[model samples]
Target: MMGNVDIFEMMANRYDTPERIQISKATADAIRKYLVDTHDKNAIDFGCGTGLVGMNLLNDFNSMLFLDPSQKMIEQIKQKIDDFNIRNADTLCFDFEKESRTNLQADYIFMAQVLLHINDVELVLSRLYDILNVGGHLLIVDFNKNDEIVSDKVHNGFDQNNLTELMTKIGYREIQSKTFYFGSKLFMNHDASLFILDSRR
Candidate 1:
């Protein structure tokens, strides 16, 4: 829908503020609980910005892929990887919505605060569903829909029940979701709540 590459590219350098790090830490903690054992599993943090969530959860997987359309954002993740001496992570600058990208299969796929930015939600969800290995899991963390937050480019947020129904339509099974965190000014400077949805392929 909206081209977020330019906006994210400009924010790449200063993206990791204390507030963001705290939020990522909370997200990582929630995800960690669902990971039974990830020593041999491969994970992808789709739309990962600066490796905040993926980096924090790196130890749970054998390999982690950071994908985003903004080169500057990828650059920031690379820098963090280097600074932290992280060896199990890789970066790819690809936009699944606009580009024909391939050869990416993961045991786990994590998306945090990303679904709202896309123009076509179902198409992107279908693409992501196709990229997972059989029996793999998809974890989506995003805001619950808010009528107060309005934007022409973004979807305000999503309703958990509606999102679950969409995932079901896309062929996901054993889907489970819950709201795990709440924050003030979390979305467009308005108070919003965050939820995590887990679905099996």
Candidate 2:
């Protein structure tokens, strides 16, 4: 297991890199199209590294809790959002790996590039399900098994069939997934997929 401090620092640096920035932008745009079309103002961003996804959510939300396990990552996010003068967000350095919904809840819970590292996807899904209000949604953007290159590493990428089965077993219904591009043509044409699930089932 990575120490909290090291994980934060690593993610802080990772978020600052150009590759991550590009990927974050694509992920954010896809999320907006998928979940923010209805535009609920209350949301939570789990593993919100550098607030990349949170920043994009700002246009569609009034209140958002940005949660992560790394103080360094949160600090970087604070600086990034502060540089742009965004203040309607809250930060919590809680490790979902070790913590549950004991302290927070939201209408929409979003996580980008975070689920691949989760060893207990079902347990985490259950926890998120507990915190989400009725009619709430959970949106996860991560690498999919179709990405032939990075699929081997970096992400525990899943095929749509497997993901649907996994979420169904966890009591999440209306599970859907779609693929999208990241970076320029140099990257895989379909490098990522966004999985959306409604907690009410």
Candidate 3:
């Protein structure tokens, strides 16, 4: 079976299609609603492939880190950052689930359309919780459960209630979750909706 990193590396060059940009825009907009004027804050975009979502939100933070498992994806994001003359952002290629590459800390950690790709969701969430500074926020954007979507590698989707319970178990507080966007044929050609869940560590 092809690992997630290899799969993403192969798709890196062609990953930023029009459809994807649209989806990212929607996700970013939803995230923006919950954001405050934190010009001095730092953020990390975990599983930040090509930085479509993270790049759009760079102005919201003082500095941003784009972290992905695929080297090619990180390369693409670096190119985008340079091409746009975005000085506040940097890119790193690391598989957070398997190893720790940097001892960086952040006030905010954003994950958009990333949870569905993770197999051990609880473990990943726990790791994220540990890296977040006290009172830091973890913002997650992922699809709501859809029975119509089936896959061997990706999760079918997520149940917000179950996910909230897991987040609580991981020591998060002030958890707030809501469905933010809906699209037709969004997930594996099945009609699906996306949700944004924000929690403080």
Which candidate's lDDT is highest? 1
Model 1 agreement with the true structure over 1-201: per-residue lDDT tens digits: 575778899999999999999999999999888897788999999999888999888988999999998999999998888998999999999998886555789999999998988888888888998899999999999999999987887899899999999999999998899999999988899999999999999
lDDT of 2 by residue, 1-201 (tens): 322346557657665677666767777887777664445457888888778877777878768888888888888877766787776788888876676756576878888867766766777878888888777788887665554555332454657678778778877777777767533343345434444433343
lDDT of 2 at 123: 79
Estimate every model's Cα lDDT from 0 to 1.
0.91, 0.70, 0.88
Which candidate, 2 or 3, would have the higher lDDT against the true structure? 3
**Candidate 1, TM-score vs. the true structure?**
0.97
Best model number under TM-score: 1
Q: Please give the distance, in angstroms, between residue 45's alpha carbon in candidate 2 and its true position after superposition.
A: 1.3
Q: How many residue pairs clash in all the candidates, one count each?
A: 0, 0, 0
lDDT of 1: 0.91
- What is the alpha-carbon lDDT for the whole of candidate 3? 0.88
